[model samples]
Target: MRSTSLTTGYDIAILGGGVAGCVLAARLSEDPGRTVCLLEAGKDYGPHQQAWPQKVLNARALPRDDVWERHAAVHRIRARILGGSSCINGCWNTWGSASDHAEWSRAGGPMWTAPAMERFRRAAVEQMGLRAVPDGEFSLWSRAALAAARELGYQEVDMASPDGGPGYGTPLLNSVDGLRWNAAFAYLDAEVRSRPNLSIISGASVDRAAVRAGRVRGVDIVVDGQRETVHADTYVVACGTFGSPAVLMRSGIGPASQLRETGIRTEIDLPGVGAQLVDQPGIFVPLTPTADLNTSLAAKQASGDLYVSRMLIRAASALCPDGSWDLHINPTAGPPLFGRLPPGEYEAGISALLMKPASRGRVRLRSADHADALDIDPAFLSDPAGHDVAAIRSGLEIVQELAASAALKSLAGPAADGHPAQDLSDQELRDRVGTYWHPVGTCAMGTPDDPLAVVDGEARVRGVSNLRVVDASILPTAPAANTQLPVLAIAEMLADSLRG
Candidate 1:
């Protein structure tokens, strides 16, 4: 649905109505003089609360997140609806630490420093109603895990600074009034949406940017199976890690060999268009609860007032690094979406996440068509140092230690798959791992001299004018935690830069 006037050209055209897209469109339109168009391939719920899907608004673990593309276990569970994956993701509000931002600054510039971005962080907390999960809501299983975490020397279980050292605690989340408060609600409220200069078009799939002489002139989009061109003075590709790269590759702007093979004419020979993909790979240990406990959690979940709150365990300095956590140990009791085990096989799980993975992946065009899913090879656990698997193993050992302790005695079941921890092979490590739902760096922004860079420090596309990439795709590296908050903050900072 188009909301702006029938103008032939706009000041800005934003591709992908995800977290960053919604934010950029809103912030840019605030000028009132700029004509902005936000195009989304997915359905938009609009400004009315009743228009939103109950499943999308409710902060529950829908089965939509578990749908995976089976190529080496690529959990391709991104939200196709408005607000992007934040519409479908677990609502944990994890911001990576100061050191994480410091690393980002080295790639981009001093503008990406934590202090420069802190205002956006505060804005997110205020607008999303982010608050701590109360102690009263802790399940019987979580209470035991809390005691176990303390017993295992994780004294500070409360959520610490995103840049600080490890701690185990119930975290702040984005759920308010039992519904998911996604980016659309935060940035595209009725007041913003009603602006005359702003237009939002849903179900508008972008094919490619129409570039001429290294400058974006317009975008070719597919609306209701018909081709149309939307002219814009400037364009922002915020389609995300997998998408922004695919769009560029299809527009004849990627590696020359890949473009030639696809039967597309070459525009710019960008080797990093779909390279340097990074994500946090993880594994889970499943455990069966006593029949009585299982029955109880099932009943509470049916009530739906509140469900699926959890605490996290981050591994300490000895295991990963001195400044930041290397492992994320999270436990779930009621949520089936957290199930990595086979269907109906277990009632509880302990997920061991390998944060700061050294292994890199690549996303390539399956075909020139925007509809074809990209060929994604995360190459997880391929790190030469083997540090990724080692840190995860350390986290699993902690899970075992917790289970065997008196606090959780008889509450936690036996080890999953019957494989002794030390006996598991490298193949087993690769086979058992999955995603933490955070993927990044497919269009990483860095110093222009860097060969792998796609966009620059200010988010402007390298070698291209009137174009920028403002999304998780431009994340130089994956932040230490979930990508939702960080992605939004990055958009806010870039929006300011664009305005200037």
Candidate 2:
């Protein structure tokens, strides 16, 4: 990490040193002559894992430290660290179905086709050191979940492969011995950090890009209460889904009407800058574990081998496209996600996640101040056609069946509430909805003809010559799987394009 006072002009400036930003810095800095600066709004903690906080390194639980907003709404939580959400998210990785790529290809041209992006996906997997769940890591509850899935007739398939259809499988993990291996550990290792051409500046909050005459000449960032402009020939925004659009809106490059409301003069009338927000919403069905199951889970926890979840079912609802799944049936047991349990006791539950939802949301700025919170509405289960609600209901049916399976019934019983999740009304379902934390599509990708497209297929901003957005924000649609690996692969693919 370098001091901002010592920073000067560079060939390229990569904003937001999250997962994608780390990859971009490591990849683009390969050419020593092309200087690159990577800026992060949180602490870097250096390149060594020992220097990172224990909570951030523990893969057994999601850490709330070093996040953008402490104690904020659960759905609005995002990391504010050098490695981004990878430092705090579940260490699991899974690829999306072929239908997800089909949608991406439609918006971003042939480059986004599954076949075209296979190499980059492989590259990200290898670089991240992702591996299958070890037998030791599987708790007694996880074993029962797998058995229940098989009992329900779901075939075992490779969850990390894009060619697979509906099935039950364990996702590849980016954790080794319960230690989270975040993007900084994978991409910006000691060797990469030694590169003279690459400068990583942490605790630098970006205000906006200095856009002049359809080009970004510099970016205004505040560091330690002082503002500075970092000049660069090119700029890439990798601020994840939420932060990316907020940055663009602050730059006066969004809907003119909304910008005016915030007292920001519109520099570019790009309606898509903060529109079309999407995220996966799910409902959890809690189960009461048997005394025997509790004992086994306590033993596993004492042995330091307890993991909340290890396997999941990729299931297709009746309304889902043929040969694709729209729901993820996850069986989790261990420590509760929200609160602590009594000694020797554990929380168990299964979640039904609506993967491909028809509902859309928006991200809008409340005021011109960068410190103000942006209005983010996920709009889950809000589709006019009721497709999203119907899909979730179908998933709940599967969850009920799984709980009733002989394999699962012996380990746990139904919730005391005695209410079948599928029987819930529309309003009830909405009240209980939770996010999968996979948000995308605010700055969607599309061709020039698309009125709402924020960037072109190559990730170049429509009206800005030297600025691009390379992150989950440009995904156009949410993938069926978690966004971690896909975001890594997208960054790798776009790094190649930017290099060319």
Predicted candidate 1 versus true structure: per-residue lDDT over 425-446, tens digit per residue = 8889788888887889889888
* Model 1 steric clash pairs: 96-162, 97-162, 97-163, 98-163, 157-168, 157-169
- Using all chains and alpha carbons, the TM-scores for the candidates as numbered come to 0.93, 0.99
Indicate the TM-score of model 1. 0.93
Give me the overall lDDT of model 2.
0.93
lDDT of each: 0.78, 0.93
Task: Give stretches of model 2 more than 4 Å off.
Answer: 3-7
Root-mean-square deviation of each candidate, in angstroms?
A: 2.7, 0.9
Stretches of model 1 off by over 4 angstroms after superposition: 1-7, 63-74, 157-160, 317-319, 338-346, 415-417
Note the residue pairs that clash in candidate 2.
none
Task: Judging by lDDT against the true structure, name the best candidate.
Answer: 2
